[model samples]
Target chain A: MISMHLTYDAQKVYMKVLEECLKASSIEYELNGWSEVKLKGQPALSEIRTFKNKLREAGIYVIENSRHELIQRTKDTISEMILHQEDLKSPKLSTYLTEKLNYSYTYLSKIFSEHTHYSIEHFVILKKIDYAKKLLLESRLSLTQISYKLGYSSVGHLSKQFKKTTGMTPTAFYNIIQKRNRTL
Target chain B: MIRGFLKLAVVEDDKSSKKLFQKAINESTLVAGMIFFQQSNELLEYIDGPQNHVPDIIFLKLDPMVKNFLKDLRQVRKQHQLRNTLIVIYSSGASEQLIEDTFVYGANVYMDKPHTYEKFREVVEKILKINFQYLESNLNIENFIYRT
Candidate 1:
């Protein structure tokens, strides 16, 4: 669904494309491999291809294909983060991601937003719900158990977010998927 | 120049299909090494990671995730200016829309994951024969172009 994390390779190539896409538009850039701290504005995409070729002429290569790795990495990190938590409600998710990825929240968010067409918060929520859907559909884990597994604070929170994203409550959604499966 | 076994990345989310396909490949006469990854992410990384090691061919197991994956792969191909790699989509999922979309996104071939292992072997044999013929014709074409 829309909630699956952008794979890491896709994220990398995506950010590189975003970086080059911005560079092509004459927007200045900066990076701190450990601490992402600054961003300025939206990119001009009118002459994007021209700049892409120009960058190529300079011998710098951006990822040339799929964003699969990028999304995969992000999900892996999220999964790992949740997997480590003893209490899903009190997860140190933000700290874990920032520390592990070695980028300031601001920079990661900015670059991700520039590349993905979604904000980091929105993306993370999508990922959580996607995982929840997966857990809900694939296994018979109780809602509370799935919530804890997903690092959710409570079943209420999970139900609320699940409803928000899927337009159906978790129980309802699971039932539908179950009925659909039986038919198939 | 170092010559290595041809590398193929097989992307499939399902475990059984992955095993079945790998078994089929192993039993076949193809001179290749197989690296299996369950998700598109690993496949994408193999192509664009720090090594920039694009495989000779990639077989994507078509599913809902594949459509968006192809779209993203297009960006990577464009950014890297890569042409040596061939992407082939295989699925026993049997979705016409998926097959059509894959071709639209530049998949080299879309074939059903054969029902029988022998059928899989036949497909591989045909692919190899075709490539050998293509190589012979390719040399001729280059000679003709140069002469012209």
Candidate 2:
């Protein structure tokens, strides 16, 4: 669930309208909210179809089975922290997530991996690199300054990974994109 | 027929699925009312507004009740007096009791999206047809009730 805050009225509107429609159609559902709640995995297949029809009526966008849940969650965490304060590093990221969400690092890691097929640490690295990509494309920061800003120990380390993932060195990417923009 | 556009709202969390839904809806000439929200709160806000841009339907790809989703609905019931905002809860799976609880908390539609897009389109068509009839009769009764 995307969680920041939710008003009571929205929740009521969802539950009330959804309940009335599905019951009439005799299609069972878990209206309370959980994208991972799979009706086919639990209910009969034909019934699931009828139920889905009812949802379309309500304009309730239902997401079937999937694991982008974790990806979105982590993005929210990153965006929130970065928006509020800058200069956080990955060394402390695991601990921060653990503390903020109140789950053991092990449990979060396991669930995230099982669902997403990506290790939590790798996901974090990807996010940090993503942040670096934004800065490189959008900001005037020097590579050394960006390395320090992203908590990389040094510019060489940042360059090695940046080139590996993006297929261009930071300077090369910046110049290339800039030139492309000029042409446009 | 309302004969303008089919107003629709999609509330799903998965990015790939959401993209597909948007693409499908955009390509379809049948849908006139198309809006998208990734989370519940945004959809809820639209439902609660003064003009209440209530989509003719709302598609809620519910997440697990990690935070008491039922409670959220009950709160809305108390606050908005919102009526007829069709809510469809689509998930991959659920239990018998959980399914029952969907009604207990108030869901108008419940669907489990299948693997095939053909089946998906079939499902969308069927519901649109049914609701078109249902809404027509429903408006009459609602008018009778409200007038009294």
Candidate 3:
């Protein structure tokens, strides 16, 4: 029964990921957001790639069931943390992951690194950097406000991390964004 | 049919549950708009803060993490003078005593979170009918806790 429930849930997630991908594309598809989605035609590989990348850019991690379930949960939890910026502040990342995933932080870290070829901390930093990039482009919020919103201890800390990850300072990215917008 | 356009707010932490609920609600034309909140704090903030769209009905999922969620919800309704808003507590399971306490605290209805998609749609439809049609027909204070 437990396995049945788990399989059901995995299928549900699989359906949702497909539905999201369909919605992201320009092609129309008939979906009730449940059951199998009926597509008008097969999407091109490039179109599928774009859709997948879009989901990733939004920090929505959709994993295959054939892979380890733990890996999927870990990725989902991390993505959720990054997507919902509110959770970034409290309990610390390790503590939050432990409580949420119901596994020891060490165990989670080991599994995550083993499967993903990146440390959990590295993954979180990448997600944070991704979120920071979005905030810079999309909102009029000040650097300090964005820094605090993403749970950085200080603006300087955020900048240092941002620079380290993105190969450009946050302000420099913002300036480039501003210039591009002006040209458009 | 529902008498008028409805504004609804749902406070459910689980992403899958929230998605299912929203999908069910989207099938109906009765609702004009809906707001989704994932936590008690966010819900409280929205209700307390300046917002033009005060929901006609609110569906809140009980979370063990928020010990004072029901109490705070009651206070929000009273303090904000949202006396006419119908508050529904959605839980998979709760003791009778806890259900009674929620009723005493200002919840207008209690419903179990249905497992199947069809049941979820049915629950939403039934609640809307009972609350809007029955209550609006005759503002009866007696018809409160709904169970299934």
Candidate 4:
């Protein structure tokens, strides 16, 4: 006999239930996060009713508010772009959001700013600088390599943004880490 | 000179959230030790006690139900021993005003509470990887809140 222990995540279980519900309703959709879903096409009233019933049976409620839905989709799309940097093919973030979300950059930015009180460009810069910091700490990548990987035109550009966001240059950040490690 | 491994502390009242935090911290290679306090007062007491280990990072759950969340944050910032310690605050649904308040009160990072295990793990890992000793005192509002 073999003995083993397994732990189940509640969120994963909810996701599986959601997937089952969506499939049973024949809805074509993409799962962004646990609560956000992007349906491919508008389902008929009856179909929507049935889908909602199924999901409710599993203790899930679809968010019917269009504004909330759009905001969630925009945030998810930006996160996907940042997480999968190599897969990004759009020349600029504005174009990329437009292509992915099927909304003009101006409209999308307007909605994002109205809802979040910050511009989409500012959000993107924050995420990119965060990713850069993570890469600098976790990887052996040099300054130039990190800059290129994050799509900066030059090392100086990356440094300027990093300093602006973090209040210290990359070299200074690394020096602090080194000094801490040496003391350890 | 601090130890090679990171010491972490979390002040959360929700049992499930605490469990998720324990699981995430356990899975990380960077965290050497972690302490959990059910209330901010308990954490403050522990920090005030003699011979207690000072954590390198402190994670506080900013729930409205929890009384004096901001007061506790201010107390933590006032501690000279924790001057360089990174303070991360998280909430499920926080307004812009509340987030701005946390930044003003000296939190280095504000996280939108992750609803999934994968995202929680990723957030914890990313936070652990950063070198925050030099950046804690200089954090700006633009980079204050980290959403995963």
Candidate 5:
């Protein structure tokens, strides 16, 4: 007999349950990130009530605070920009955020720092580097192509930022990944 | 010939445990120096002072009995200078919720406190050998915890 309890990925389950709740409420929404959902428009209080009730049954609670919601929106926007490569067209991330969120960049950044304990610029760098790692692992793009895709002016610029965020150069990082694959 | 190249800091309060930790860290070839802090505030002050001393890796003892254990973890992460610094949280037997909380709050690694000094040295050496920069980039719940 198999004598063990089955385990499931909590994040996966959370996402599934969230989608079910949204569908049940007939709310049009987009999953911005693992933890954020972007609704098409303002959700009515009754719709929110039902959604909250469904999520509560799954042990998930909606963040009710406006500040927390704003933070999530900011993170979602940043993640979307980086993962989708939407920033390539935008002249500046600050201006893009100001226009999209209708809040001054200064105010958005200050509140973001107050809550997350890191600047928005730092967060963007981290996200971009993370996306770069994904692209590297996929092995579909060259380093120069990745640099251009991430909107870096030059390969040297991308390497500099990558090295700063991660202690090793991109080539070094790729070598480690190769070594790990061989070992496995 | 040149060992002890890695700077380490330990936030531990128990006197006997501190001695054991120091002995294990001293035996590790990768550790060049180690500092012991009986309180988290002392470590924070040391890191935040004008001198700007930041250790490569910090071993934080997570004890529920201790007040502000999670708060101290967050405080350490708040330092911009410590962004690249690795935080290894060790506990005798921490709850699942607490361990998850540590990860969400930016701890790079979670370890179970080893009973034997030999095991402690081994753990220290193994942790130092791993490239934390790569680990940090690919961090997830599956790889967050360290096991011997």
Candidate 6:
């Protein structure tokens, strides 16, 4: 059984993906968790490959191993945090993840990089920039307000990161959007 | 910046209409920032310049005389930056064909511009009250083209 409590929508999406995978493979399986399954008989490599492909086609992540699953959870947690504009002062990301997952940051970082080919810090930066982009075009907040909302140290810090990631200043990006909106 | 404010941009050529529109927007607490353009070209130019501040929502007034303007607007909307912004078409003499065309061209709302300032303010307030992001996440694109 899946241990974590999921909303109705989340459960529906997960169940659909699970049902699809089960249908693709003839072997019976025991559900250990939402993403974990135990096959009754030793399934052939071909059968597993087919099931994986079906899940991918349905836009679901194929968890190869426990490490991969942990990485995915980390990513999901970080994204949700950034999307909600969670305050930075509460706890550092590493500390929060460590406490939430009950794993040391060192172990988490090592596994994350090994599986995802990106550092946890780098992934956080990318997610923050993506969130910033949406906030810029969708909200009336100024750069200063946006910086604080995203938990950047300051407006200057946010600008530097934004420029480094996007190859242009936030103002420039805004201008491009503005120009696009008025073209007609 | 004021919290919970909506940034608005107005693109219209009629002087009286522009004045009324600005007055209505200014009267609303939801409006944090606003910019006006007499011609679509002026708005385009402002956006192209280095000092661009993208608005969250745009109030676009369509003129019947400017056949090329609609075509130009469609072309402008093709850019990536404008993808997230909501485009609301404000028109007085919209034919059924033009309304259909506007929806096809990716407008989110089709509003008949009211003559009275009071009515205009009410319409603007109603539009602002809508949480566009929430509506978008629902993924029902068909209902996006709201008419008034």
* Model 5 bad stretches (over 4 Å): A1-184, B1-4, B131-148
The alpha-carbon deviation from the true structure for residue A43 of candidate 1, after best TM-score superposition, in angstroms, is 5.3
Please write out the lDDT profile of model 5 over residues A25-99, one tens digit for every residue.
888899988778777775554566688798899898876588767877887788777765634674589987897
Kindly list the per-residue Cα lDDT of model 2 for residues A72-158, writing each as its tens digit: 465467555543334454537677777777667787777765444346665555555556767777788888888888777799998
Q: Is the docking of candidate 2 incorrect, acceptable, medium or high quality?
A: incorrect
lDDT of 6 by residue, A60-114 (tens): 7765567656866887788777766645565588888888889999999998765
Which segments of candidate 3 are over 4 A away from where they belong? A1-184, B1-3, B141-143
Q: Order the numbered candidates by TM-score, best leading.
A: 4, 6, 5, 3, 1, 2
Better of 3 and 6 by DockQ: 6
Better of 1 and 5 by DockQ: 5
Worst 10 residues of 6 chain A by lDDT: A175-184
Interface RMSD of each: 23.4, 26.7, 26.5, 15.9, 18.2, 17.5
Candidate 4, residues A13-66, lDDT tens digits: the string is: 998898899888787989886778877874554566688898888889865568
lDDT of candidate 5 over B1-148, digit per residue (tens): 1121467889988998988887776665455578999877899889888998888788888888877777778788767877767888888898877775666566666777788888877766666654232222332322222332
Query: Across residues B1-148, which tens digit of lDDT does each residue of candidate 4 receive?
Result: 1233578899987899989999998776556679999887788789889976688889988886656767778788778878767788888898877765665566766778888999989877766655332232122322233333
lDDT, candidate 6, B1-148, per-residue tens: 1123567778987889878987887676555678888776777777777987677777888877787856866865654656666778888888977765665566666688887889989877766644233222222322233456
Any idea what lDDT model 5 has? 0.72
Clashing pairs in 6: A184-B72, A184-B73
lDDT of 2 at B14: 77
Count clashes in each candidate, considering only residues at least 3 apart in sequence or on different chains: 24, 51, 0, 0, 2, 2
Best by DockQ: 4
For all candidates, state DockQ relative to the true structure. Answer: 0.02, 0.02, 0.01, 0.06, 0.04, 0.03
On TM-score, the stronger of 3 and 4 is 4
Model 4, runs deviating above 4 Å: A1-184, B1-3, B131-148
- DockQ: which is higher, 2 or 6? 6
